[model samples]
Target: MYIIQDKRFYVCLVVACAAVFAAIILIPNWNRLERGHGASPRVLTIGPDFTRKSLAGHLVLVEGVAPHEGIEDIVSGRGTHREIALSGNLALGYRTDETWLKVEMERADFRRRNLFLWMQPSVLDHVRVYLVERHGLDAPRITEIGQIGDNDPDYLWNGVGSYLILEYKEPVSQYYDLYFNIGSTSSILLSGHIGTVEQFNNRMYASDLTVGFYISFLMTVSFIFVVLFFRSFSKNALYFALFSFMYAVNIMIPARMYELLPVAVDMNVMDIVNVQSLILLHIAGALFFRQYFELWITNEGLNSLSLWLCAMLLAMAIGAGLGGWQAIMPIELGVVAIALWLYFFEYVRQFLSGRKLSRAGLLGTGLYSVEVSTYHLILIGAVAPDGPSLSIIYLANALFILLFTLGLIEEAAVQERRNRLSLNLRLARRAEQTAVRLAREMTRELEEAKVAAEKALETERRAQAEQLRFVDVISHQLLTPVAVIKSSVASLRRSVGEAGGDDAMRLQRIETAVRRLRETIDVSLVRSRISSVGGRARKRKVVLVTELQKIVERSCRLFPSRDVTLEFDNLDLSARANIDVEMLGIAIGNLIDNALKFSDREEPVAVTVSRDGDELSIAVRDRGIGVPVDEIPKVKERYYRGSNAASYFGTGLGLDIVNQVALAHGGRLEVENAPVGGLVARLAIVGEFDPG
Candidate 1:
């Protein structure tokens, strides 16, 4: 159940590791203690023309003397130096006091070539080389000599390897005696090989190439890890970047890389730096393994210890970088030993718990731990002579790292799968709840919509019935007036004919007025019903001008005192329409009635009729207060009137009726405010209403 989400676990892991590291540093070991020096020379024989085998194990024992015995006095054979019988290929151990080595090399063809001696200690601080010619084992004569050290102003050699030389001639000298004085701040490990010029040069070049390649490889790997860390925020990549950087630096110092540079470096500084870098490498490696294995949560105690070690190592490293005392390299080594032991312990715990992943990881890491242990012991000269070689340690590390990389990949895959499963379960629960809620909402909304639709249909049915009843009432009221007008017009026409020609025109006007009145009443009554009931106005050929003339006379007779003007245009062009002459007339009469109703009796009402192409239009204007600007848009709505017209004695259905009539006759009604004063209403009967 443990996951990367537990951040507190990681914090504790770091603190515990750092504290343990600090404790580790409190104990010093082999790095601070000094070793005894060699006192006598070990002699050697070399072949001619630079042909001598490597001295990997041959130069084990040699004569060694203390620092106070000067080279001049020693060559005079006065010092009481002793023979040092070294057991291995190199001298190992830390020593602050200077020690001298004496070697006598004789060759068959000494006159023909120069002899080269290659001594590499990697950490030596200073060295003095003196080559003396021995004539019949008599008092030695100084023929050639040189000195080099970490503090020397000039690098006598082109590379980091410490080399000395001796020369001989058949006449002057055939045998050479060599003396070298060496000392270092950290350790005085000495290893050497003697050969002619050709052999020494070949081996030195090869050594440089190998070291250079190794350092470059480590740097490249470190750079790659740093870039990976930045790209993905991968924790493993970050720790590995630290590990690779430290590993590179540790190797560089031991290889005497500082000697090859243009600047001189104090061996003391390099000594501390090497120790610190090594400790940091172990710390980074520990952190990487902890996270990579999921041990930070499962093995809480182990995680805490690892983190404590990391913090302490970091503190020690910073101090070393800033020139803190560094005589306690062995303490750091001791910490490294403890960390490695913890790594094994954690792996074993995981293994015992039946974790296959941990078990597989243990197989690789166990090999890795063995190699690390061997390396540390070798550094302090604790490893037996027949034990694993340095080359085997490097090989084991490369293989174990590859195996660890595989294990990390497997672990990541497992974690990712678990996360996806958790996410899917969460989404499923949300979807189930949303589905149930949406079903309920949809059902409720459908029921609400159905009830609303039924109510709307019932209201519409009642409104249609009311409109039919209203039309019937209006038709009944207009019938009696129509009949009375017809009767009166007939009586007047007959009387005028009998009385003579003088009353003939006036009688004809009476008849025309009566006919127009009947037409308007019929149109208004029939057109008020809904158009969908198949109700339509009766159409006839009616002259628009003649109808306008009749309406003006009727208005004059009805109002008696009000002045109404009739304007006719395009009359000569036969301005006629096959409209319900009565419906068209009613629409025009409604406009005039509205005009007269809203205006003062003193103001003249204008009724205008015109024609253009197949269209007939009647325009009426009144010099009264115009329709209010705010009410103009909705003035055509049924039972709607302007605020100004509210006190007038009339229903507000006139314009609405006219609007329906115009639509039934294939025309439109337009209302506007007159330019000079009152309101103008125009009824445009368009689209060939002319009767054949």
Candidate 2:
């Protein structure tokens, strides 16, 4: 089914092209048939009421060499003159030979009126008309009526064109012969009309209106395209604008628009301009289609070929301008024909391959191909029509422009739609990617949350275990002191019946045991307070020496027999510091207590307070058993008891509490063995102290 459809498309294309070719050949022949072939001479009778008459079938044409005596030699039959009846305009292609046309006219009545002879395509190189009055053939009197050439200053121009016109002022003879001598480097086409003054004026008015409108339309379209090109920078618009403008100029040159200029331009130069405009028109057309069809993408070969053809046309135009090569016209027409066919063929091939081609482009190209080829065929004398009619060519061009403009609009819309669809597709893909990324991120976050929850649960379990162990340690420490107190009290009661010395000793033992129990409770309370407050400290200004003196006095009273001595070196008794007083006092007392508990009763534990620079130091030195060197670092850890502390009734939190207090004050606790014996624990506080 698809094969059949494809074959049908090809068949339609072939049939359409064949029909156009057939019309191009048949139409001109049909026109020629309607205007009968000029085989016999027909005399035109000019009555007083005659307005106009075409000299087509009423003329006899003869081709010969230029005579030195001019029309006299032709009239006297001095040379061989082969004359034939001309059926239409003289289309003797590109001839330099002289051609003479004879028109026979007879006056019917004596109502004399001025008569005019008009000739078209005024680019003819030379033209001379002679009026011959035959008085019964007794040596016919020949008088030159008018002479005009392309370069002649006497050339006549009407508002319509640079066409040749000759005026006859007086009509004396009843029978007259009008002889036309014409020659050209370009195509020899002489279409003439004879009419009265009113008739000539009327024809001129109509021709002016038609030609004026055609030129105006072309210029207007060219200006519009020029504006569009600047606005959009579109190559299609630019080339089409050039094509329209050149075509307008091409038409105007033949219509004798140059005659309206202030400076009289030589017709030969205008002829060069005419040929150059045609060349430019073809070049612009090639470039316009190259862009319009997007041939650069669809077919690079055709694109390059179009550019090459344009370059050749440009060279030919330059040559025509420099040397006036009238032969370039036919060559230019041939190039345009080839370019049009190539473009059309490529478009059709692309269409059949299912590439989206513009329907308007196809129609425009088809119509243009037919009309332009027909026109070229007529210009080259391949058809019966001698030349293209102005009206037909102008209408064909206008329709082609309309169709091409429609094609441009259609292509623009299609491009816009494609761009929109592509943008939507890209957006959809981006959205899909974002969704996938979000899903992956969510999965990662959920995994991380699960791990964090597990870590929190494990930490809580370990904290609970530590709390239970702490409670057990506190209970064991309290029970030891309670047991000692119970034993000492029972011994005191038993010693009541003994001597006074024994009873005093037992009371002293009970007193020491009670103090130990109170100390243990105080240590637990300080630990709880420190834990609750964390790293925060409430500081106030106080005299450091005075605060240290109170701590020393309390320690002395607690261990009276241990001889805890308070000492200082260069002590500033009135110096004040911003410190937490109670915390500092507790830390200092813990150092003294630990010294007393770890050493012998007669060890003389010394407490020294001093200041150096910004640092305040309270050192407690004991002269007894010191800490093991290896276990020194671990002694300041909470609830950490040393191996040497087995025989002592002490909680392991004293040094740790002192360290915490030192850190809270932005200071440090230093513990080391004294040089003599035992350990020296220094509570160093660094702060701004006022000395008085």
Candidate 3:
């Protein structure tokens, strides 16, 4: 089957080529031979005959006559009639008595010839005419006007309607005009000059304008497709392509509109469309090349490029508005081309350095190269060569573009599939490594933590043993003082009843010493009571402020009242905290007592309770010699004291013990100088408190 089909393909190809050759050979050569041009110039024997209504939809024709006769008559010093008479020479040798309508001048002397050869009567059947005068424009004047009778080929308006007008024709003057009339339809002298009506009819109505529009539109759509298909490509290229295509289209707009509808032609519209497109073309080219190259120099290169392009575009628009079309096009195209070339050079360098030329790039680059090549060819056609077939070149370029683009898409899909498989494989390997490493680290961390915890437990056990031994030694040392006091108390009691005056005095002294010793023991017991309460940790609760306040009041009464005063600043009532009330109170009490001991009698110490967010603060500020700046940090350490305060009567343990109590209750003591020239011992408890 495959062999048979392959053989049939070659057979079909041969048949197709044969068919095309045969058709080409059979076609007539009338157009190629210029046979249509001299066919008697198709004279109008009489008038075109049709009503205006019947001619509404029919195509009319009018011929343009150059006023060559008028000029020739003047150069010969002949009158306008001399030019009118020269019409005989103007008549191409035809054996017809039917004279097509001819133009004669009324302003100049009608001595020799008619300067203008008017439109043929049959021209009204297929074309519309606008008369061209030598100088000043005027409406068409009536000469000989009538309709042809039916069945008369020599004078009939074949397609539609007809009208004739013979305006004043001046010789050697730039002040004559022409008119066009179809049945009742007619237009007078136009404001602008008519160059060549034949050229206008041939070129303006040509499909080239539409073809240009479609080319621009197709390029724009193709660029957009490129952007979508090649996601890896930068968005800037897509944008540039879009803008360039749009700019090109914009440039062709005026010509397109004029060709499609000649009624709306004007200088302003032409200027705007032409100038804007030129400016846009350059801007698009610059940006497209810049993005395509990835030529980022500065940190904000893209931003800078965008700004510059926008500014240039704006400047060009302004220039076009002020300078008009003639000045704008050259300037815009030149600047744009220069800027783009620079950008393209930079881009090429960058692209060559890092870009891995993929199948897509190959396709894109190939299409672009072809496009550039054809553009140059088009330039050649416009300048050096006159007969190059632009359509064939464009068609080839389009076909290559479409085919390569489709191939690029297919290549990208295959690449994406490979990437997905590779990515999945890498993920699997990474997952395996992660699982193994995580398990090993976790096991090592767990073993290390177990060993550290055991070491911590042993250390704590030793510390407890040391503490118990110290307590035992303290108890033993305390026993001797107790025994001595007991013996002295007994001797004093015995002597009180039996001795004389001297003996009584000794007894009284002994009794006084015993009583002081008893008081010392009781004070020690009170210290132990405070310590016990401080040491018993419990889950914290609200009412930290109230407990702090109570401690302040009690401590103030128990301390020396001579010079120091304890002033309790009210707390914020809304505050609350979680703490052991007893522990908190003892902590605050220790702080207050320490403050009063260090404070001078003349200035009252201030006890303030305040709350900030979720934390509570109690400040026991003393108007006394402040803690030395260097010793402030050490004051919170156990059994540590400020050098200045160490010489005072109180034990150095007061602040140390206070700190422990504070920590046990989830708080801390910070000692700093008060703004009022004293030490401010602030206890920060991390809980809500009502400082009211």
Candidate 4:
């Protein structure tokens, strides 16, 4: 039979593998060049205290905070004052002291809500403030702690807000000390919650490095998981690599901007390079993902959509390049939103389809999704002038990026478990098949042995029946001759008294024949009984030469007047085999009787015993009339007589008896006419001969 190995499974495996690559590499890179479009950005604000006499009444500026964690001096000013300068710029890259203040005030709403606007303790339940300051001379430090006020308001729409304050005086002398009350608070007003210091730091890095690293790791892990999980789909390694390279480039752009903008660029333009890089990476990510997922993207449709997206991005890039970062912000957000929505819809649809999913696939998809949402919210907050949406977005980015990373780890674990299960299943199935095969073979062997045993039993039954039948024939032969001889002896005595000498002589001859017959019958009877019980054959091994010699000597003793000649011409027949000595003697006794009875007294009766190869042959030849061809075939049949030999005073069962005895010893009788005009009866018996 022929079998066709199908390739569809391989194809499906390839497709599934391609999906993971798209998520990890393609999406992250596409986000790089699309302004703030690809994945969202995060900004974290830590250690804020706003009160009547603390940070609430002061205008503060911060710079040179670490990528995710560190310390920076906060200035009480309207902008980036040299006195309070942090030796670095803010996230947006605008360096003028006055402009930064305007941006913060407008965005923080410090003018509308007084210094106590975010002093609500109820809504900002988790907020705690600490202040540590250094004095001159020995640089002694002082620490102050504050808690949110109890008399704060709460609202359903406005969940929480952040405002931090601190107070300090410039050093006059080495031993002078100055201090004031500082307040940091979250109001229960418009914009939502403020997270912890750790949470805020994570969100800031999320846009610059955290989100990028998470996505890149997911892409890398997913590719590896697919390669191992489905070895057959490993050919897609190149696609994943390409996507990863693009995502790496995107992440590098943002990370470089975050570091370099503070040192080399204006504060207002700090986000320009990162935002542009994100836009470019996003476009590339989308294209690669589409290809990897085998998404339905007609050339015409893709080209058209790409042209519009490219036009918008190019315009935004030009605006930022020309130092009109504020003017391009709206257009950038609008274009980015449309492009991102399309990608989101496409991915969601594909995921919903009955696609094969690996742990990496689901993880990457989920992380990418959260990143998209965060980007949107942050973009809105970054462009908004009066709300704390920027801070809120930064906090959310941190939460989402961490969540996505955790998801990736879990998915990897799941993939490992499933792979193990599949391997175990294969091993189990192989074991079952082997067991079934062994059982079938054992059953067949048992059946064959049973059949062989039955055949041997049937053979034994047939041999037993043949023995009983031979016994019955022997009984009749003995009884009939004994009765005739007894009658002849009684008649001979009476004739001698009544008739004359002639009558007495004839009766005497009959009496002699009867006596000889009685002796032969007695021997035959004993042989038959012993052979029937299987005793004679089990007693001793009969020698072919000795048995044949005894049979010829007995034949001469019974009929001494006959010319019986025992001839041996290099006929060294001495092989030992399992046989009954008595049975052999009786069978040879009968063959010799027939040969003597049929031959003329002057004719020679020859007996020869010899071995040829692995068998022993004993021949008794007589110079008497040979059997008629048609009657010869029936000579071994019990009670059968030849037409020419019917008048002879002899039972017709002698040769049949000889045949039965020969068969019991695994020998056979063959009768044929000699060239010299006589019947030659040969017994061919297999001796215990080893050819080797």
Q: Which candidate gets the maximum lDDT versus the true structure?
A: 2
For each candidate, give its TM-score against the true structure.
0.54, 0.56, 0.31, 0.33
The per-model lDDT (C-alpha) reads 0.64, 0.73, 0.47, 0.48
Candidate 3, 8: how far from true, in Å? 26
- Ranking of predictions according to TM-score: 2, 1, 4, 3
Model 3: which ten-residue window has the lowest total lDDT? 184-193
Off by over 4 Å in 3: 1-409, 424-428, 465-536, 539-589, 596-621, 630-634, 646-653, 666-670, 674-677, 684-692
Report each candidate's C-alpha RMSD, comma-separated, in the order given.
13.7, 17.2, 20.6, 21.7
Query: What's model 4's lDDT at 104?
Result: 16
lDDT of 2 by residue, 1-692 (tens): 12222333433443355445434333322222213344366788898678688776777876453565478787777776655676655555555456677888889987777888887642367788888988874998988888866666776667454467778754588888898877553543456788988888887898788789878988987888787667556788789889889988988987887768999687678878888888888888888877776642266555556666667788889989896555556555655666677678767777878877677788778767766766565554444332245445556677888887666655545655776788798899899899889988998998898889889877975785566458557856776767777776767667675557766686777777776787777787677666556656788988877887887898788777778778877776777888888788889889988888888887888888887877878899998689899998888998888898888888888999999999998889998998878999998887568655
- Stretches > 4 Å off in candidate 1: 1-42, 48-67, 90-92, 155-174, 252-275, 322-326, 358-364, 383-388, 405-692
RMSD score of candidate 1 (Å): 13.7
